[model samples]
Target: MQADIQLLLTADGSHTVRHETLGVTYHSIHGAVQESQRVFIELGLQAAFERFANVPLRVFEMGFGTGLNALLTAREAERHGRPVAYTGVEAYPLPPEESQKLNFDVALGTTFLNALHASPWHETVNISPFFTLNKQQTSLQNWQTNERFHLVYYDAFAPSAQPELWEPEIFQRLACFLLPGGLLTTYCSKSYVQRNLRAAGFTVEKHPGPARKREVLRAISPPIL
Candidate 1:
């Protein structure tokens, strides 16, 4: 089925698009520009990178909508002088032309906007020495990789919108992609989602959600053998 996309102004004064079928929302709030910096860049990614305190950090994101998460992550990696290797998966690919019209730079800053535009579409593209963003235009169901990730941003649609993606099998697949002691964070606070993650072998926790959100989910895997 074709996805229904519409643009709307969010409370944060950012432009956001809602994917009706997936019941997913994308911040056109400069598109990924806002989401990347706020959700992952400042909160999740930086915290993980600091705890790791390593030269290079590896990140994997389940939903790459608007590429906001990738752009923000690249900016953070550059600021810390740490190299970041990122892999993102998205089922519906947006064209570069449409992406450029997002105006994410005005709010996210010109540098981040340019870096985001420079990221290539339809392939794994390296934007800078410290950051690399790769995208796969396919659903998570088709996802297969042996690479282990240190951090995962679980941004899939809500269970009500895409029940299959939120199933135990999908969470199990996510567990397979993580390195020992890896962590997963999401904006969702659904008990069923937490239960699924636990069933898939993750140590799940409920955390304070972002602004206006009541709760969120954080999951971690034990150290690898």
Candidate 2:
């Protein structure tokens, strides 16, 4: 483990990494697995699947910390026999040595996770027939892409960890990356966060959060003016 990182066992027996320097964990300490399954997969991916059945869905994730969200999404795509093209942007990717210590593969009973971690950054890898992943190692502020997505998993650390990410300019860029009516879900439901999304032209809603959290936000993109 890196000197600045510590692995913590969450309430659900899952491992989460705490960045001692950044003062944040990769996932909620309540239960890393449950948080991903609820916020990203169930709320974001599953809901999008309902409206985009039989279509190859495009998903963009802001932070690909442990690859947990991507792994769960791949399973969901296979379970429903749908296809998903996932793009995850991480300014600072977790080291392979540390990510290897995570037990999500065994916990989820999946083998492709190893492949996800091995796949080189900045290239799209076909991890499964139903799932394609593109991991970009660049900050959202500096990253550029013309592709749009149907759903976005805003899994970045809390505003306290990286306040710049929660600003209005970032939300405006995210809004432009989505097709009209597309969904963006995150574990954050802070009032100012909602205001930023609204300022960026999203119709925001608060939904019941998973353990240790009260609410989450799911925002819909409106046509760009």
Q: Going through the candidates in order, what is the number of backbone clashes in each?
A: 4, 0
Residue 192 in model 2: lDDT: 99
lDDT of each: 0.72, 0.91
Candidate 1's error at 149, in angstroms? 0.7
Residue 111 deviation, candidate 1, in Å?
2.9
Give TM per candidate: 0.87, 0.97
After the best TM-score superposition of candidate 1, give how far the Cα of residue 129 lies from its true spot, in angstroms. 2.1
**lDDT at position 76, candidate 2:** 90
TM-score of 1: 0.87
Query: Model 1, 28-73: lDDT tens per residue?
Result: 2333344445456555787678667765778999887766677677
Cα lDDT tens digits, model 2, 66-139, are 89999999999889989999999987777888889899888888887788888999999999999999999889
- On the 0 to 100 scale, the lDDT of residue 47 in model 1 is 67
Model 2 off-target regions past 4 Å? 1-3, 223-225
